[model samples]
Target chain A: MVNPLEIKVERNKHKKTKPPQDQLGFGVHFTDHMFVMDYAQEKGWYHPRIVPYQPIVLDPAAKVFHYGQTIFEGLKAYRTGDGRTLLFRPQKNIERMNRSNERLSVPQLDEALFLSALQQLIAADQDWIPSGAGTSLYIRPFVIATQPALGVSPSEHYQFIIIMSPVGAYYPEGINPVKIFVEAEYVRAVIGGVGEAKTAGNYAAGLKAQEAAKELGYSQVLWLDGVHRTYIEEVGSMNVFFKINGTVLTPALNGSILDGITRSSMIQLLKHLDIPIEERMISIEELYEAGRNGTLEEAFGTGTAAVISPIGELSWKGEKLVIQDGQTGELSKKLYDTLTGIQKGSLADPFGWMVEVSETPSGVL
Target chain B: MVNPLEIKVERNKHKKTKPPQDQLGFGVHFTDHMFVMDYAQEKGWYHPRIVPYQPIVLDPAAKVFHYGQTIFEGLKAYRTGDGRTLLFRPQKNIERMNRSNERLSVPQLDEALFLSALQQLIAADQDWIPSGAGTSLYIRPFVIATQPALGVSPSEHYQFIIIMSPVGAYYPEGINPVKIFVEAEYVRAVIGGVGEAKTAGNYAAGLKAQEAAKELGYSQVLWLDGVHRTYIEEVGSMNVFFKINGTVLTPALNGSILDGITRSSMIQLLKHLDIPIEERMISIEELYEAGRNGTLEEAFGTGTAAVISPIGELSWKGEKLVIQDGQTGELSKKLYDTLTGIQKGSLADPFGWMVEVSETPSGVL
Candidate 1:
């Protein structure tokens, strides 16, 4: 467990100058410090500390490199207008990460310790938090198998690390709607697989289709269920949503689709706003039929990085469907504003999703 | 590409003492030297060299750690009776690795460069080769995305590393047949996924089912197709085959089953022997019916590690099916002898598969 009093902080002797706020792109630049904890089968988890951000040296035979025994969580820290920082529903991310660990056979992490560790690391790198509009410090917490062996079983040793990167808008075009390609030739996951968990393998297995979609001038690929290849599962790395005839619908968690925190929050927000929403299987054919009948009102992808990414167009099997006249939909805009407002402390905390930095022990440092 | 005269080798300053030959297990022990090369989008692949086996230093945000953008090939260097070392179908492994690279969006390595690299590495650690019966030096050549960024796309930088480990018999019980649990609840791969590719994610997605099978007292799991969960896919990490009524049947490469080098070689050998074999979809139901009627004469799994692993028993959905009275079939023994005989260079090299070490620059080195 992370004890704010017990966490050893090793300050960097030579600190790197922060990149220009506007130039920050995704996970390209890292903050000064990182939080790390080690896990062994016999000793469990030990040695929680904050140290200078540096490359990790691992044996060539580490299982993480060979078997892809790794899991990760991604969230962002928003700098409010009043100079306060906030994290939106970070406990959900930690809970999902533990589920991922269970599927990957990694040890379960204590949720309170995990949250405290993130707060400590954020405290150590508070200067890196960007205050620019649509800019925030992206936090990536991951666990990797470090046992120096080539066997395919679960590793005996593991390392849990949290790294921070100041990132701008997820899409370079800001909140604009983007074109998507419906992938039918490849599958990201199947039922009874590790797709529900935030493991590295799902992304690795998806690179080929993603690259192809990018080359075809599409922003991302809309993946279908592996078994049926008919029902929509996700869009790129985000959970997808569609507004058909004034009803919001997203895919159900059918063992292969990731249970994204952003997607859940959006569902809750939609319900709060008195909008009808349902989590069910939405097939491409049905969506296209709705498009033909002028009932496909809005579509978007929800994730931690993008919050809400509107889908302007979808091309499936050589057929193209323009969504909302290739523009950002009204609901997508409202959801994004409401969510970001809560995250940045600009609105009243109705649902109480945001956890302010001052509420944690960051002030103690 | 592998000009023996052009290769540079660095010997380890502190050589590791060899473990007992018979006690050598799987990938726990490493040789002194390893093959390494680097690739950048601008520089292609450069700096091919043999260095002392050591840990690889990488930024915490390297794509391989976060997205599992890694591909690997596994083969062995076998010491012949004439005191020469050989690699069985080494080029096949390279070709398969290239296919895996394409699927994982990793850069493809030149086959010539890959072969030369292996020979150079084996040359540097020739002394570590074990001479005991059934002992061979296992070589694992893998490529990983090394770009220090977390954004999920093709990596701009990569590393190709080859490490060797001396291993004894794959099964401690010799060639005895083992029980296999038919996995109906979990699917290893689907038709439109990275199942055929030799990537880390495929293996990582399979650990849970494998662990559960082991706990059920089974040697490995017999995977079914992801869509139907009826057609047989593979057995653990190996390709499976069955002999029914003097005819051999194996699941076709239907874009899901791995094109195992050993499986291909066995097919070629069976064709040469005028044996009838079919590479088509074979369902567990059909096999079970044959087992009940006593027409399923032999069942075996093939891979680089275990050339012919007999399946003595199969438990599908709690229905037990025993074959050959829980004994190794006659054909299983014959195929094992023939494959191992070809690999060790004690038998005829009719297929021209074995690449002798002396044929390359190893003798000069």
Candidate 2:
């Protein structure tokens, strides 16, 4: 029988004992160790290890550095109220990672192997997980081309790494409101591009627009269709949701906009709460008009890190449309509460999304 | 008077000797040193140097690795009959790199600085230039977000680098014809994506299609429009051109096909040679009909590396359209020769395209 691959971890010899409340921004503080697996054409993924948090060395000609052949997944390791560490729906991340890898022509890895590796790595670095109020160990699993070839062909070698960062609340004080810029000139995703995939290229393409929005006093950009720049796609990293009349409307996954884990969770959560949700194309005109007529009750964005962030005002095309009470709406708070509650084990995980981590040798076998 | 920036050379102590002629494939042989510059929001671009060609150490959380915030420009240094090294249309590359940086939200580098860096790098790597026929030093100038952050925002820190690789002729035995696989299912670029920009993401997106074509024993995938997947975009990295009724036609630069340096160069060369050339939307239907009606004389793909590679056959929709003679056609060879002639200083630089890199460095104080 094939042995369950294990990782060796060297704990941080000098550990910090202070519970600093300031070390809580999302993706700011990382755990001590990380999981890594290397792959080559000659030999499959090997040299799996849990190494101390350090820089990765790569060839200057590596395709990932110059060509951007990279994809990543975001999930979290939450410490429950019951004092148990659990991962939420990690299989989804594994499956999506493969899909992205396939699209980018990166070498693929075993999903079961990946999940086990994550479990082991996180177990070792679990102490680095921040507890208390909306804080959790953010798990970032990513794969990249490591081949040193400079030609424009698919790389034969690859690296799959799982790194953990203790992240604070997305919103400093629970969930407040955010001003979003309606990006018209800049398009994040197109009909046939890597918009749906969590590829680095998609995110990189949005940086300028995001920078512009931030300078203009906007938190994020609400991307539109690349063709006509009319319909909404996504808000930088999150999936957008708009409440028009009664139905919660989100732009349908039309080959653009990331199929976010939180977006999917919200859809499932709405089903449990018996709330009507419509997954269809939501145009900018419809959103603006609905806001002006008071038909828009709320607008928010969903992603793994930020369970739900309310939209206060949309700055776009010489007009500012106020969404809801210019603050976190009731429905947005409800979604965040339920999701976080279930995550922290305060509420029962009836959906069986959380996989409880076994405390033995920690992440090592 | 602004003094010209001087490059500090840190040569590799253990540099490998140049490989033999047979092994000198395109982009396979690198020079001893590379030029680098670092940019940050706080300090702008600084620490410009020509360092040893070695593997770069990058943090696992570098944005370029995870977010793909990278862009690159390609040009070549050819050894002229008088033993002088030259870059063809180097300013065009600088201009294009900035355009690409704008699309990716990376900072724009000064054109003067870019040329100076290139000159220094090439001077240091001049020994690597192959003197044989059709051999030149392929220069890859790229910018990558080196910020050790996981966020999707535009990185505050960026690394700009220029590396040289001595490359042999694309086709060792004269210009050989290539078979193309027209991918109907997968679309490379769309209406408003980074297709026009020489960004890393655009290349990453095409890898899968290229792999599929390779698996099928074809050279490259002929991409089409994303929505309809009908109109011809380009074949992999190069712009496709077809000769019908003694007139040359190429797919219009309609946001999908790259505005290739060689593509435009050929158009200029053909027009100067009294050949009628049109840059307009080219459809798959038009190509197939033209090929079948014996009106299509030649078809070729143009890029920096292989200035003009003739398309032998096209496999699409269960049908095959064999280009005339299924060999390097007359117009293809003419276009290739004319372009190379200008590039090699054999012909006049009519458009004032070639910017001579003066050895004396007289432009600066």
Give the C-alpha miss distance for residue A90 in model 1, angstroms. Answer: 1.0
Structure candidate 2, residue pairs in collision? A120-A363, A123-A363, A124-A363
Off by over 4 Å in 2: A1-3, A10-19, A171-174, A361-365, B1-3, B171-174, B346-352, B355-365
Flag clash pairs in model 1.
none
Candidate 2 Cα deviation (angstroms), residue B230: 3.5
lDDT tens digits by residue: candidate 2, A1-365: 11345545555565545347556676756667778888888887787777777788987788887778888999998998767998888998899888888778776778777877888887777777767888888899998888876788888888888888888876554488888999887777776667888898888777878888989989889998976778898998789898888889888988777888889988898888888998998889988889888899999999887778888899879799987769888899898888889887888887888888776544354
Per candidate, the number of residue pairs that clash is: 0, 3
lDDT of 2 by residue, B271-309 (tens): 888999998888899889999899999999998988788
TM-score of chain B of each: 0.97, 0.95
Candidate whose TM-score is highest: 1
What local lDDT score does residue B338 receive in model 2, on the 0 to 100 scale? 75
